[model samples]
Target chain A: MIRTENLCKRYSRVEAVSDLNLDVRAGTVFGFVGENGAGKTTTMSILATLTQPTSGRAYVGGAEVTADAAAVRRQIGYMPDVFGVYDDLTVAEYLEFYGTAYGVTTPVIEARRAELLDMVRLTDKADAYVNTLSRGMQQRLGVARCLMHDPQVLILDEPASGLDPRSRIDMREIVKGLRERGKTVLISSHILPELADMCDEIGIIAHGKLVACAAVEVVAARANGQRQLAFDLLSGGQALAHAFRHERGVTDVLTCNETSVEILYSGSEEDQVALVRGVTLAGYPLKAVREVGASLEDLFLRLTEEPVLPSGA
Target chain B: MHNVLRGWVLHNPLLHKELRQRMRSGRTVLGLSMYLLIIGAVAFVFMYLNVQGQTLLLQPARTAELFTFLSYLQLALISFVTPGVAAGVISGERERQTLSVLLTTPLLPASVIFTKWVTSISFLSLLMIMTLPLYSIVFLFGGVAPSQVLAVFILQLITLGAIAGASIFWSTFIQRTGWSTVLSYATVGGIFLGAGVAGYLFDSLSTHMPDQGLWSMLSGICYTINPIYMQAALESSRGFFTPTFHNSLVESVFQTVKTHNLTSSGSWMFFMSVYVGGCLVLLGLCSWHLRPGTFAAAVRRFGRWLVR
Candidate 1:
């Protein structure tokens, strides 16, 4: 339902989104993971038809975002990162306004407004002023506003950001419900584990470029096959961590404590055994040597740390 | 076509929402009360000071004077209130961050601008209507005709519409409500008042005589748009109101060209067309830039063809 081809957005001298290619199939949740300034919001804005790309093309629901923006808007519901509301209007009035703006019939708007307010758990606050509601309630109201037209696609930028833990859980459940109802959602967050819990496929972006895109379990399985080693000693693990930087197949080193370090190693068993013996024989008082299970956090850290490649690479 | 008209005029969501919010506001109620009170007090005070316990009988000139004073007062108040009402229409939405979500709906940019314009002008219309009981003073004395009252209202509405349009343009051009309001006030003050001032300064500074062709035409325009001058003319024209205003367009244009100056009626027409019509044109340009339509696309294509 959403696709972009080499989408590039530039602001003066800075490239906000550089050659970003993305695809989200119908009826699936695609989580866009990136840190701040990693171009997640820019990409989402392009797909929402709010920002025109400097180069290349974006599409939502098979319509080009720029050329057929009205159609694209008709098909997709967009929730910006910041929750915006008309302060003086009541919750029901706010929803009614957007419904009429979207050309939804009055009957359908009332019916859907009731259903959506219930889904977002704000049915009781329907008559209350929007600004009087809590932040979480306002965020939920924003989601309800987008769904007023019963769109098939939803582009939510950082829907869970700045929410309390309970609010985050509530948002996750709402998104889960959306998926169950067969809506395509492209959600973005800088946090990976949050997306891991909800997304069917995850794309990790860094430096305005997408570095990795895969199904959740596929990325997790790749992490499972990773060869990382952890060490515990009496002291001076920092010095050995410095030494292991030159060690073969030791891709990256993380110093956990003064006496402990975790090494991302992809060497054969022979090299591993040799390294273990070398650490023990080096008079470091090695307490333990164990293989550390790789996680999505480790993979995300490793992927973001690497430099972006040239276009064709 | 019928449904579209109904939606725009009857079911316009933006207009309905704005009107509902503003009508429910305590400030609006307070403003209307204060406005009516001030106008009524000023009129009664004028009558008391001048009449000196005598009946208003045979006081046609005093009533006419009172009518013109009220018209000028209303014009000044409307001029001040218009920019404040309209300058925030678009930029406030942006500051609240609602404009982005609004654009992502099926609503056209034209509808948004039009509804905002109507919403604001309709409130001004309500204020004008509220002053009618006060205008009854003029009517009771039998100096002002019913048609003159309607004419005065129509003139005020047109002037206010033009000012509101300029405010909308500023609202669209600027992103923040604070600066948009500043520029909107500047536009009203500069266009209406500054035109007269600048024209006077030019006449003073120049060696050329005021009766010459271009200078006289330009000076005529300077007064036509000035509300004070238009209302002043409304007093004199109350006797005739230009019976020949229904003259053929060609004859009017020919007379304007032959005289090298605008007639009284020609002056108002010129003022209305230049201010209101010019605002409509510029506002259309701003809307097209905000939501580029087929005209822009076609222009780009034409440029490409020229390059080819």
Candidate 2:
């Protein structure tokens, strides 16, 4: 439901976001992963219609952001990275204020207020002053505020940034619930594992470019060419290494101890099976043999490696 | 139009919420109370002084004149107080990061601006209204006309509206609420002080009968263009105490013949119109400033010009 075509934003002499292209389909959670200064916030701000792009174009819900900003705003909800809470207001009052801003009828807002607060698990804190709540509670309140209008799209920047483990888990569940409800969410976060768990598709940005964008599994597979295999042999370490050394797909096999070995091999499932058979036939007792897939953390680091353009060409 | 009205109606919750928050805020309450105390002390001193004179007390017309004079003085005080009340309206929202939430809503920028202005000036107007009892006490002595009092209060509200509009306009340009507050005060104070000084010097030179140098040119401009001059002229003719400008070549030259014959209320109405018009212009400027692309580009252009 959101797209940007080579969108660029320049602040005086500095280019904050350049040649950035993004497409987020409806009913999917798109994770925007980036380090600091990756222009994630700038891109989100442009999408939110809070700031105008210097060049290029962006659209939300099929309406051009620059041309039909108010319409786009009506269709999307934006929660900033550093969302500030009005301390004096109660949680209910805070929601009510935004409800009015979204042009929801008072009765509808009131009816939905209880449901939203319950969804965020802030029902007890409805009458509590917002500032008195913990940071995680405040962040949940911000999420609830964005949901006040039942917006079709949610652009949340770093919604899980500062939350504790339990709060982060809660946030992930809330996001998953949004996805299930068919709301498109574009979330940016530093925590790749959490994003991997929640996002249907991922975009890794670095130095103002979307360096990698794909499904989590696809990205992990591309980044990891070789599968890692570890075994705790009942007897044979030396013989297993000797046998693995001669194998075509197995490249590096290191003996961990008297009974354990680790191997790195670029091979299909059949090749892995054949290696297992060879180990068995070699008369060494095999206790375990399994392929290890790459983690999101590993893929993230690999894709975000510094770009090295060749020297002086 | 229906959407606009709906937006305006929707803004009331925000308005009510803001007003309640301001009332509860210690700084706002403290500032307002201090202002009221100062006004009370000033009124007490003025009443005591008049009681000591006994001369003003004896003449009913003079007493009415004196009350009108005090009312005008209160209007001048409101002119100063308004910017302080309104300088942070928009900037404060930005500082709190609530502005983005407001902007993303369906509410138009003008409605936002209008609602903020009304909320701020309503606070100032409440303070002004509190002094009504003091005015009524003066009226009990049978000197000031109710029409005169009503006219002055209306003028004060209009002037307050203008100041509030100007402050909000400036608030949109600056980042920090504190800086906006300071800059608003400086701007409003500078205008009144500058105009008063220029008007005084020109009046002095034109009446001194010496070579009317630059002062002669400015005197014509001041008489025709300055709202303060219009106010002073209207007040002076109504027997309120104000400096008398001598009938001079410049005054005759610049003064519209038809305007010169207008009654005091008519002149007051004219000045009020100017004040309201000035307020609308300021509101328009504020709305322009709040538009997405204008503010940042303007700042960049200004920075470039400064560098050059």
Candidate 3:
């Protein structure tokens, strides 16, 4: 398990991470979602013990990161967003090198190296120079390297940041594999959907403050008390869209095409029913209507659209 | 003891990795061969001169000259190679983004520093050992005794340690490899320049009055402080050995070298103690600074101390 209480880090005039309170359970993946410079990497770096927070305490596996960094380090495996490899070393040697550095026993390192290489699917490139591997291969190799010590927790920062679609899917599967192995993972990424499918809980940060942290579905559904409704009309689409924009609960209307439009709806089910009934009674050719489910993307955009208040506020 | 030693070497993957990367390439072999070639050529040139002059009688002097020349050459090689070997070690790791990951492992900063320092010195130690046969040629043909040779080597080893400590310090303190290397060379150059100025001043002053002046005393101290100059004092030392070997290996080696006239004047022993202590402190500071926020932490402590 990993936890942070009021963690803050500042660099001279800039506050990188401010008053962040986080708790990750023992064997679940927690997705950290934020845009560029949203303190995601800064938080991960503090947890990974690469940087010391200016204030507050962080613990991994019951060991405080600063007071007992050695213990925390032993329990956690960390992967930075962009990493460099030893070009001179083969994949296996690179893994072996870190394994020995992590103080894994000889037999255990050998056995786990084999299993991890297989898990990350780098067994075939075991003898190939790391520099010769593609970016995706190297990312997979990083996963394998992180797992070499058989750590209980993994803190991955943008593990699929620059990967192709296929590689991202592959990375997702590897993370799924980690979940199956009962390892706690704290993953941060700019991809909302990537986190939505994999994370049990998601934390959305904005402007150095955490705006929301909840279950994946809960955060998606709590999008500023609003939802969207799509209206597919056979005729009078433009006129209906214009009329919908003036409706009491409809905040805005978007014309998707000549026959399809979406209206931002913020009202009760009775109100939505009344509006639809009115549209039908007015003799407009209404084909179909469906309420759009709020997604992480919508929630992310809503939360980040306005300047975020500090956590305490 | 056996298990501890085995664990120390076996558990040190950084050391093994560095050695593997360096040795697997043909570069180390090429460097060793080049080292042998240079020492050999110098010996051959001296041999040719001796034979052409038909001076078998001056063979003792020539052998002393050869030994001194080769040892200086060895010191120069160490001076030239140490910055290249050491100045990029920690900075290169940081540049490659490996230092953060390395720090996150259970390996202590001390361990990282020690491993890199040992790796650098071990290669130089190997180079010195490789040239031992050539050194043996100088030892056999000269009035130079075994203790004097040992003293010279002790000086060279300490010289290597001093240079390595300085270079590794710069490498850890500076962010870029190129800059660290330049500073490492600058540190070496600064020492040589200071000593050269002192030596020149001493020469100029000694030619005039019975008074040797401050530069004369400083010159003598620099001769001991600078290992390259210290070798000259060691070469002119006693031509034989009579060590009582009562203390430890290091202490006895110092004692054997202490029998020389330089130590009788107390300057060599004083400089050796201070220089070795300074090297250790430099290494310790390098290790301490490798931790995160150590600079800010140190600054805070210093501020608190000032307030107090």
Candidate 4:
């Protein structure tokens, strides 16, 4: 539903977004992860047609963003990280105004307004002035405003940035609902775990570059054998460590306590099993053995870390 | 086109909403009261002077001249006041942070500009209408014809619309509401003052020679190009039926005041056409400047250079 080719946005001497390529499929929730100043907002703004890219091209729903911007706008709904609400307008009035702006007919706008307000769970606040609502409620209203025209693509920039824990959960559920309704969504957020739970595909960007992009499961699987394994031994701590020191699959082992040891290993599942058996036969009573799966948080940190440059001769 | 119009009308709820809010606003009420007080005081002083000197009241044409004179005074007041009403139209939206939402809609930037221009003029129109009773009072004393009054009002509306349009355009170009408002006033004031000075200089330079000099030709061109000059000429011709009062301060100040004759002049029509056309072109330029791609490109380039 969205694609960019060597997209580069330069402001004088700073490259906010550089040579980045992305393809987000229709009906999939794509989470864009990045730290502050990581080009997430800049990328989203370019896609929203709120900013022009310095070079390259982007297409939304088959319409070239630069060449066919009006048509692209018709198909995409943009919700900025911070949007202003009319202080005097009721929630329903605000939605209706945007509906009209988006060229929705009166009757259709009314029907859609009702549906969207309900979808965001703000039906009860329809008559309430937007400014009178709490921050979370206002954010929900922003979501409803985006959905007013029934857009095919949705770009949400940090929709949960300042929300409380409960509000964040509610936002996640709303995003999940959008995915279920077959809308292509691109969400940017700093919370990696929440993204892991909600996104069908994830991309990690750092220093204006997209370092990693793939399905969550695929990224996890690629890091499988490279994972660190932790073992809890009940007794024979010194002997078990000595025995595993020369094992083929185990690269490095660190004893955290008298009963627990962590090991970095490069091995298949069978090799892991054999290593566990070898440890048990060496006289240490094994209480528990488990392969620690790399969390999205870990993956994000590792990918964002700057590569070390070789020293000059 | 139908959709565009409908979307434009509905998209800017702020237009009507703002008009209604201003009408009920305390500031507006105070302004209206102040205007009425000023007009009333001026009329009262003129009437008292005429009543005290019975010789001045004998000629019925003098009464008609008084009404025409007062109408011109009102027009002058509107010219000065309309800018204050419109200077904040677009800049205020940006100040309130509502501009982003308004800009993001499917409505074209031109539509937004047009709506803002209309809203500003409409507010001024309402104030003018509210002062209709004052004009009506002029009729009671005799001498003012309804058609002459109507012509003056219409010309005032058009001239004010042009000024307001220019102000709105400037507001969109500048960043701060305060600066835009000040700049708008300065620009309008500058144009009026500059044109008058240039015209006078040309007139003086031409008189010094037996032949019409370059300065005279330039003066004629400037007057023909200026919208205010066109409006004044139109009003003078349409209001030719009224007689002049030589004793009034207005008459002494405007010694060349022409009596009413409604026949439109070719030069007047040319100037009016230019004024209307220039307003449309400015509105278009404002819209183009506010479009997303233009703003984005400027911002992106500036952002890059700033980082370096």
Candidate 5:
């Protein structure tokens, strides 16, 4: 539902978004992972029709953002980072105002306002002033405001940036619900694990370029194939290392001490279990065994550490 | 056509939302009350001071003078307050980080600018309309005609459009509300005071020589550009109000024009077109500023045309 082709945005001398290409399919959650000034917000803004690219094109719902901006606007709901609410308005009134601004009818807005407030879990606080809500509640209200027009594509930039852990979880669930409702959501965040949990596809953007883009499971599977297995032995650590050094699935075993060894095992969990059973049956001292999972951070570092190609390339 | 008109009248969402928010605001309520109170107090106090140590009677001249005072007072207050009302329209949205979200809706820049203009002018209209009970003082005394009151209001409306256009232009051009407000006031003030001084110099230079056609016409143009001079003429014409005008450059030049066989309404028409045309130009500038890509695209097309 959202696509960018060689989109470049320059502000005076600084290139905020440089030759970026992206494709987000309909009805799937695409997480944009990047650090500050990685051009994530700029890319999202261009897709939302808020910023014009210096060159190339962007489209939402098959309409070019710059040429058919009004149509694209009708098809996408954009939530900006560091947004604010009208302090004088109540939560319901805020949603009602945005609904009206989006050209939603009174009757339609009245119905959607209730539904959206309920969806964001602000139904009970509907009559309360927006300024009275907490930060987390306000962020949720921002999401509700975006969904007020029922746009098919949602452009959310840093939706859970400043929230506490529980609030972040709440926001993650809200996004998960959006996916279930079949809305294409393009969300950018620094929270990789949360994105990993919620996104079907993840794109890592660095230095104003997309370095890696793929499904979460595919990336995780590639990273998970190499396991860091550690074992502490009461004795015979040399025997354990020698026994596992020649094993088919064991790549390398580093003997830490006379009583401990760590193995880099490229094997399935079942194979590792069988190998451990064989070691125990062979009567080598095996006090403990633990497999450490590869974190999203490790993947992010491995991806970003790769050499970036030239812009046109 | 009917649907378009109906949509503009009843279904303009930005206009509706702005009106709702403004009407419910305590600041708006306080502003209305304070505006009415100031006008009432000024009228009563002027009456008391004029009748001090004299027997109070229904004097036509006193009432007429009071009418002029009230009109000038209204003009001054509207001029000063309008920039505050409009200069923050766009920039405040930016400050709140709501501008991007607002733009990502189906609203074009023209629609948003139209809504801002309508909402600000509507608030000013409400303030003007609420002063009618006070204007009834002049009506009860039988000095001012209903048409004169209507004329004064129409002149005020034109002035409102002019100043509101400047405010909107500054609001679009500047990113900071503070700077926009300051520049808005400066624009209005520069037109009133700057044109007043320049018009005076031109009038003095051309008063004795009516045959100096170009100088006299230039002087007339300068006088017409000042909102204060225009309001003074509208208020003082045909005994609508008979107070001594502080700035006589426009009125004096207008009399010279009448001597040269030009109708008084000609002056009104000339300046009406000028103010309204200038307002449209400023609004166009505002729309251009709000949509940056429009400017860039124009530049690109111009470049390609130049090369061709």
Candidate 6:
């Protein structure tokens, strides 16, 4: 749905985005993660055709952004991080303005305006001035504005930034719904866990280069080499610990206390479950058992901590 | 033809948005009312002083004087109000962070500027139209013909376009609205007041010089370029319109055009063309500035294509 070919954008001495390539498949949400000034916005801006890349090229739905910018613009909806509203316009008028800008006819705008307002939950505030709405409502309106043309690709730069917890959740749910409708979204944010949960693929960019890109499960598996399993034993901890050490997938075992045992088990999930049944049938009383894998937060920190390579290196 | 016209009218979304916002805001009403009050008061004062103790009546000569006075006053007001209306067109969008969003759409840079130009002209046109009753009063007295009044409006339209173009150009170049507005006023002042002063000084100096001297030539050039002086000379040449007002320098340009045997209307058209041409040039520059980095990018791309 969106692709960049070694895209590089330089502003004088500063390289805002350099040697960056991205591929977002159709019908999937791609979450872009980066710290402040990490070139996330710059990359998205290039794709949106708001700024020309100093070199290299980008395309949306196979149309070169620079060569066929009008076509690219028609296919994509861009929501900048700090968007401004026409303060004097009511919510409906604001949407109508954008709808007309995209050359949508009046009848279509009228019909779509109602559905958009309902989707953004701004139906009751249709007649109210946009400036009077809360920040969360305005952000939702921004989302609706992007969706007004029923675009094929959505490039949202930090859509959830600066929102309260409830608003953030609301935004998350809205993005999830977009995916359900089979819309391709490329979202950037500082929140790692939210991206991990919502995104089919996550790409981490730093210092103007994409350092890591993979599916959510692949990243988690890379972060956790071995799953840690804990078992609360009714008795015979020493016997169970010995038995666990002798098991095929048990790489190491530890006695947490008289009633518990911990094992670093390298095995598939089904193998782990079967081992639990084996332990129970082997006359070891089992109270409870749990398996722990690396969380997205741990994976994010681990990846970001790696040394960043300069562009083209 | 109908479809094309409808598409042209309906496709310009920015103009619709601008008009809606302008009408809803109290600024439009306040500006129009203030405009009427100021122009109306000036007309009333002219009438009051003309009447003294006698019963108020329209005099043909007084009507000519009123036309001249109101014409100059209208030009001055148009010049003063245009920069305020246009200087914030682009800079205000940037300040509000809406320019990027607008640009990201399929909206062309030309459309953005064209809509702003139309909206500003529409506003100043309202002010120009509201003072028609004042013009009608002058028409009733029968010293100024309908054709002359129409010519003066054509001149006003040219002036409005020129000032609005310069202001929008500055707005595109400058990042801040305040600076753009200030620069627009300064540019307009240089064109009108600054040129007038220079023309006056050179005219005074040429009076003491020989007829074929360099000072006389320089004075003639200044008067030809100075719109205020040109307009004053054109109005003075016609009988009963500002009889006491005389500009020898501008009259020389008029005489030169007449020596070629161009009629008075033709001479005025030749003079007004400079203002109209200048407005087009300024608007062109404004559209260029609105798309920053595009020219260089295109140049680079062309260079690469040629190399290939």
Write out the backbone clash pairs for model 6: none
| Local accuracy of candidate 1 as per-residue lDDT tens digits, B1-308 | 99989878887888889889989888999988988888789888977876787774677766776777687788888898899999999888888888889888877787788888888888888998999988988777667787888888998998888888888888888998899899989988887679757655544444376456567656566756666556556655636322222336423333432243333678778878887897798678657755654345456668888999
Query: What are the Cα lDDT values of the candidates?
Result: 0.81, 0.76, 0.81, 0.76, 0.82, 0.81
RMSD of 1: 6.9
- Please report, as a value between 0 and 1, the fraction of native contacts recovered by candidate 6: 0.81
Docking class of 5: medium
| DockQ of model 2 vs. true complex | 0.40
List, for all models, the DockQ compared with the true complex. Answer: 0.53, 0.40, 0.52, 0.33, 0.59, 0.59
lDDT of 5 by residue, A1-313 (tens): 8888999999898888888888889999999988788899999988887788899899888999787676888888889888877767899888887888787888999999988888889999999999899999999999999899899999999999999999999999999999999999999999998999999988888788887677875655464457778887888887778878789998888546678888888888789889889878998778888765456777777666766645322
Query: Candidate 3 docking category?
Result: medium
Chain B TM-scores across candidates? 0.84, 0.74, 0.79, 0.80, 0.86, 0.82
Which 10-residue window in model 2 chain B sums to the lowest lDDT? B253-262
lDDT of 6 by residue, A1-313 (tens): 8888899999999998878988889999999988888899999988988888899989999998887777899999899999888868999999999999998988999999999889888999999999999999999999999988989999999999999999999899889988998999999988888888789998888878987777877756654566778888888877888888889998888546667898888888899889999989998888999865446777666666777744322
Each candidate structure's TM-score, on Cα atoms with residue i matched to residue i, is 0.84, 0.85, 0.86, 0.82, 0.87, 0.85
Clashes of 1: 0
Which one wins by TM-score: 1 or 6?
6
TM-score of chain A of each: 0.79, 0.86, 0.84, 0.85, 0.82, 0.84
CA RMSD, predictions in order: 6.9, 6.6, 6.4, 6.6, 4.9, 4.9
Give the residue spans of candidate 5 off by over 4 A. Answer: A220-293, A302-313, B53-56, B205-212, B239-263, B293-308
lDDT of 2 by residue, B1-308 (tens): 78666556545666767776767678877877787788778877766765676744455654554564566567667877877778888888888877886777766677678888888988898888878877786666664567767766775677678788878888888888788888878866655666556656786787687777666656544443344455445444565433222447324322432234333455555555656887898887787667665445456668888999
lDDT of residue A251 for candidate 4: 80
lDDT of 3 by residue, B35-140 (tens): 7888788777866765576644546666766676677788888788888888999999999988888888877677788888888888888888887888898666
Q: What order do candidates take by DockQ, descending?
A: 5, 6, 1, 3, 2, 4
C-alpha lDDT (0 to 100) for residue A55 of candidate 6: 93
Candidate 5, residues B120-224: lDDT per residue as tens digits? 999998989899888888877677888888888888888987898889888888999999999999988788888777766776777676666776677677777
**Residue B116 miss distance in model 6 (angstroms):** 0.5
DockQ of 3: 0.52
